[model samples]
Every structure is written in C-alpha cells, then in structure tokens.
Target chain A: MIELKNIKKSFDGLEVLKGISMTFEPGKTNLIIGQSGSGKTVLLKCMLGLYSVDSGSMLFGNRPLENMDDNQRRILRREIGMVFQGSALFDSMTVLENVMFPMQMLTDQDEKSIRAAAHEVIDRVNLNEATQKLPAELSGGMQKRVAIARAVVMRPKYLFCDEPNSGLDPKTAIVIDNLIREITKEYNITTVINSHDMNSVMEIGDTILFLKDGLKAWEGNKKQIFKTDNEAINNFVYSSRLMKKVKEVYQ
Target chain B: MKLLHHIGAYLLMLRLVFIKPTKAKVMRKLIFKDIQDLIVGSLGIVAFLSFFVGGVVAIQTALNIESPLIPKSLVGFATRQSVILEFAPTFMCIILAGKVGSFITSSIGTMRVTEQIDALEVMGINSVNYLVFPKLVAMMLLPLVINISMFLGILGGYTATLYGGFSSSADFIDGIQMDFKPFHVFYAFIKTVVFAIVLATIPAYQGYYMKGGALEVGKAATVAFVWTSIVIIVLNYMITQLLLA
Candidate 1:
C-alpha cells in the first residue's frame, strides 16, 4: 500500500497540490482524475519522486520515501514501475530490449534469463510478433502496450501510469485500461493512474480521487461516483450532455 | 553573471558525469557506439578537408614566394607550418563543431524533448553518466584522427608542390625536415585533446538542459555549436600563450 499525508507541491511559488492526504490500497486501480491544469500530473510526479514535495510525506508500504537515502531511494525506485503518458519507450531499442531494460540495469540477471523474462512480458502484452521492431514501427496502442510491458517486466511493488489512454481510440483505450486493471489484480500491485478519461474512471476506476484547482474535490469508487452530489465533481463528471443523461438514468 | 552561471553548471555536470555507472555493460555499449558515431564516422570528412586544404596552402605559399632569394623549399616549409600549426587542428575541429557537435546536441535534445532522459532518471540511472561519459571516452581517441590528418596534409602538400613545379620533390622533402621541432606536433596534439573535451561536453550540456520540442532542439544545436567553437578558439589562444609563448 502507498500513503500520502498532507502532500503539498508548488512550482515557482504557485501551489499545485494542496495538502492531499490519501491511501492507495494494494490489489486495486487507484485513479486520480482531474481536468487539465488541475494538478493531477503534478501530484503524480511528486509521488513518483520526480519532484520534491515542499511539505508532505509519502509512504511506500511502511517506509517513508522522503527519508530514504540516495542508494535506498534508488533501490526502492527499482521496485517501482512507471508508464509515462507519452509511452517513453527508448526509440533506439527494439521492443524486447526496451522491455528488458530495467532488469538489465537493476539486476545482475544473466542475458538468457533476461531475454526470457522480457519475452514473458511481451507475450503478456500480446506483443510477441513485434519483439524485434523499434517503437517507431508500432502503432499508438501497440506502443502503449510495449510501455506497459516494459514497466511491469520488473514485477514492481508499485505501478504508476500517467494518462495511459491519451491518444488511443475508445476501444483500444478500454483494452489498455482493462489490461492495467488485470495486471494490478494479478500482481496485487499498488497501482496509481492519473487520467482524465471518464470511460477509464467508470470502467476500471476501483477507487477514484477527484481534484479541482489543486484540492481534492471528491473521493470514492466508480459505483459511488455516480451517486455523489459534490458540485465540482458533478460538474466535471457530467460536463458532457451524454454523461448527464447517463447520470440521469442512474439517479 | 550568466556566463559565470553557465561555467559553474558545466563544471558541475562534469562532476556528475564522472560518477560510477550503475551498469558497466551498458556503459561499455554506449562507449563503443559513440566511438562509431563520433570518431570513426568523422574520419572521411576530416581526411578530405585535411588533404585539400593542405594542397591549397602549398599552392598559396608557392605563388607568394616570388623573390628568387627565398628558396623554393620555403613552399614545403610553409605548407608544413600552416597545416600543423593551425589548419589540421583548429580548422578541422571547427568543421567538426558543425558535424559532430550538432549531432550530439540534436540527438540528446530530442531525447530530452521525448522524455527519454526522464525515463533514464526514473529508472535511477544517472543520465549524465549514461549519456556524456561515453562521448568523452570516444573523443579521447581524437588524436588518432588528427595524426592521420597531419600525414595526409603533408602528402597533399608534397603532391601540390611537386606537380605544380614550384619545388623539386627532394627540395620539398628537405624543407619539411628543415626545422621539424617535435614540440610543435606535441603542441598541436595538446590543443586537439583539449578541443575534443569541449566538443563532447558543450553540445551535451546544451542538449541535456534544453527545454522544448523539435524546433527548440534545432535552436539548441545552433547555440551549442556557437559556444563550443567559441570555447575552442579561446582555449586555443590560452594554450598557445601558456605553452608556446
């Protein structure tokens, strides 16, 4: 499990995450949903340790992330997996190489075992046919799959996905979302995903945290989300007429 | 003040680059790749420029020595002097600042633009050590290329002087051997090594710190080249002053 206590972050004196306190349980998809410029990405980055929190504490399991020394932090980072919004696969490497990169960097595993491990993840993502191909050769959805394979190949304790469905079509987006949820359950990993896709929030958002203008607007599961009457989240969730109609039927 | 800040940052980057790599195997692969890209890839152009410029120097020197009192051997001597003292080292590096410098910047800048650098960082890799250290290793082999340039340059000078009938082969050979101070070759090589460091690191600094997309990458390459050339020229003066003054 991962926990954040009074997490606050700012850039150039402009506060972005305002005292967010939350618990992300293991074996579930924890989705942080917010509109653009609503601090979702900033909060995700802080939790990823890409940005130092001005005032806060992040606990990965029982260990406080902010208190770990450099070597300790690095060791912990190895146990963490990140799927960037852009998919950030090394364009220079083949699919297999990209998947195997973290293991090669962080472990002394022999090449034979590493290759086998990489193939296992690639097959998991249904990307076995594209093992030798570079990222440029893959479609957007395929690239996201490759990114997912690379991230989880290490069997990390924590998984972070930043807008995994951004450029994907609706059907492909659902495939990626379900894939993440399935992996989270299978590994019992503490997964945190930052997304604005309402479909993702409704489909696989086991737990959702809604943010508005740097503050938590609402917190609940997808089933609970449709019943909530919080103004900010209601406005955000039902901003579209179709979603409003869906809410009307549910209500 | 901005200049001072850049210098300090550049020095700090160097310090970071010397840190122990997380994986020696990965570092070994990167070093070999950089060798192929930065050194081996540059051989053909450096050779071409070295030879043609050497021929041009011989011809120019021969034409200007109209006074019969000045022996024709001066053509060979001047060619050797010009090639070794300035053209092969300084001019060739300036050319590389365009070819190799721009390459380092654009590639790294694109990685930055694409978040590949961030990927490395998130993986707990020291991105500087992973990226710049390989280039530094590859460029340390630069003196090998410069030695080849020096040889081809003299051969070009010999060809131009003998064919143009400006000097006999024997006289030209004798002139080249006239005041051959090994120190001058040593001095040129010292300058070459120093310039190689500038070539590898300045462009890297530009690329690593750059912010923006493809268009900004292009701009950073231009800026890296300009600063690298400036540093190379200034270092050339300083080295020459300290050692050869």
Candidate 2:
C-alpha cells in the first residue's frame, strides 16, 4: 500500500499538488482522475519518486519514501513498476528483450532464467506472437500490453500507470483496463492509474480519487462517481451529453 | 547567470553519471553497443572526409609555394604538419560534431520526449550512467578514429602530390621527415581525448534536459551541435596555447 499525507509540490512558485492526502490499497485499481491541470500526473510522479513533494510524507507501507537514502531509494525503486503514458518501450529493443530488461539489469539470474521470467509475463499479456517485433511495429493497444508486461515482469510490489489508455480505442482501452485490473489482483500489487477516461472509470476503477484545482474534489468508487453530489466532479466527469444522460439514468 | 547554472548542472550531471555505476556485465554490453553506434558506425564518413581534406591541404600547399626559391619538399612537410596538427584532430571533429553530436542529442532527446528516460529512472537505473557512460567509454576509442584520419590524411596528400606532379617523390618524402616532432603527435592525441569527452557529454546533456514535444528534439540537436562546436574551438585554442605556444 502507498499513502500520501498533505503532499504539496510546486514549480516556479506555481503549486500543482496542493496538500493532497490519499491512500491506495493493494489488489485494487486506484484511479486518480482530474482535468488536465488538476495535478493528477504530478501526484503520480511524486509517489514514483520522480518529483520530490513539498512538505508532505509519502509512505510506501510503513516507511516514508522521502526519508530513504539514495541507495535505499534505488532499492525501493526496483520494487516499483511504472507504465508511461507513451508506453515508453525502448525503441531499439524487441518486445522480448524489452520484457527481459529489468531482470537483466537488476538480477543475478542467468540468461535462461531471465528469458523464462520474461516469457511468463509476455505470455500472460498475450504478446507471445509479437515478441520479436519492435515497439513501432505494434499498435497502441499492443504497445500498452507490452508496457504492462514489462512493468509486471519483475513482480513488483507497486504498479503505476499514467494515462495508460489515452490514445486507445474504447474496446482496446477497456481491454487494457481489465488487463491492469487483473494484474493488480493476480499479484496483489498496489496499483495506481492516472486517467480521466470515463469508460475506464466505470470498468476498473476499484477506488477513485478525484482532483479539481489541485484539491481533492471527491473520492469514491465507479458507482459513487455517478451518484456523487459534488458538482465539480459531476461537471467534469459528465461533460459529454451521453455521460450526463447516463448519470441522470443512474441517479 | 543562466550560463553559470547550466555549467554547474552539467558538472553535477557528470558526477551523477559516474556515481553508483551500472553492473559491469551490463556496462560491458552497453559499451560494445556504443562502440558500434558512435565509433565503428562513423568510420565511412571519417575516412571519406579525411582523404579529401588531406588532398586539399597538399594541393593548396603545393600551389602556393610554386616559387623556385621555396624547397619542393616543403609541400610534403606542410601537408604532414597541417594534417597531423589541425585537420585530423580539430577540423575532422568539428565535422563529427555535426554527425555524431547531433545523433547523440536527437537520440537522447527523442528518448526524453518519449518518456524512455523516465522509464529507465523509474526502473531504478541511473539514466545518465545507463545512457552516457557507455558512450563515454566508447569515445575513449575516439583516438582510434583520429589515428585512421591521420594515416589516411597523409596518404591522401601523398596520392594527390604524386598525381599532381607538384614535387619529386623523394623531395616530398624528405619534407615528410623534416622537423617531425613526436611531441606534436602527443599534443594532437591530448586534443582528441579532450574532444572525445566533450563529444560524449555535451550533446548528452542537451538531449537529457530538453523540454517540450517532438519538435523540440530537432531544436535540441541543433543547440547541441552549436554548443559542442563552440566548446571544441575554444578548448582547441586553450590547449594549443598551453602546449604549443
């Protein structure tokens, strides 16, 4: 599990995360949903240790992330996995090599063992046929699957995905969502996803933290999202007529 | 102030790149990859340019010293001095700043824009060490490229001198042997080693820290080339003054 207490971050005197506090439990798809400027990515980056939080405690389990020394932090990072919004696969490596990279870098495992471990994850993600192909050859959905495979190949304790389904088609997005959700449950990993996709919200958002103007606007599950009385989240989540109609029907 | 900050940042980044090094196994593989990319991959252009430029130096030296009062062997001596002292080490690298420096910047900048560097960082890899240090090691072999340029440059001058009939072969050979200071070769090697480090790091710094979207990758490459060239020229002057003045 990961916990953030009163986490604040700013750049050039412009605050992005405004003392927001939240907790993400294991074995659930924890979604941070907000408008473009509402600090979703910032909060995710802070927890990933990509950005240092200003005046807040980030606890990965009982240990505060900010307190860990550099070596310790690197050790902790090895236990964490992230899927970038762009899918961020090494352009030069084929799918199998990409999946095997973490193990190759961080472990004492022999080539065969690393290959086996990578093969297992690649098989789980159903990328067996595409193992020899480069990232550029894969479609967006396939790329997401590869990213997911790479992220989980090490059996990391925490999984973070930023806008994993942004450019994907609806069916592909839901498929990716369900894949992430399944991986989260299968490994009992603490999974956090940053997104504003409503279809994903309804499909796999086991818990949702909604931010507006750098504040926690609301927190709830997919059902509660439709039923929430918070006007800002409602306005943002149901901006489209179809969603508004869906919300009306739900209400 | 901004320049000072970037310089400080560059120094810090170089420190970070050497700290907490990658696994030797991984680093060895990375070094080989970099050799293939940055050094071996660059042979064709280096050879081609060195040959032609050496010929130019010889021809120009031969043409200008047409006076009967000037010794014919001076053409060969001039060609040897020019190729060894400046053309092979300084001028060729300036050309490579366009070829290799842009490649380093654009490739790394593309990685930055595409979030690949972030991916490495998140995976507990030191992105600088993972990306740049191997290139640094491979570029230590840059003197190898410069060596080839030196040999081919003198050879090209020989070919041109012979074909142009500007001087007797024996006279040119005498000029080649005239006042051959071994210290000059060492000086050129020193310059090559320094430029090699600059080539590996400066463009990497530009690419690693670039902001904005896809369009910015090209801009970063251009900026990297300009900065690398400026630094090389300035350092060349400094080193020449310190060593040969």
> Candidate 1's residue-wise lDDT over B1-245, tens digit each?
99999999999999999985758898899999999999999999999988888898999998998888998888889988988888888888989999999999999999999888888888888999999999999999988888889888988999988888888998899889888999999999999999999999999999999998999999999999999999999999999999899
Instruction: List model 2 lDDT by residue over B1-245, tens digit each.
Output: 99999999999999988987888998999999989999998899999989988888989999998579999999889999999999989988888898889999999999999999999999989999999999899999999999999999988988899999988889888999999999999999999999999999999999999999889999999999999999999999999999999
Candidate 2 C-alpha lDDT tens digits along A7-81: 999999999988898999999999999999999998999999989988899999898999999988988898899
Candidate 1: give the clashing pairs: none
- TM per candidate comes to 0.98, 0.98
Model 2 interface RMSD, in angstroms?
A: 0.8
Lowest lDDT sum, 10 consecutive residues, model 2 chain A, at A242-251
lDDT at residue B64 of model 2 (Cα atoms): 95
Among all candidates shown, the one with the greatest lDDT: 2
What TM-score does candidate 2 reach?
0.98
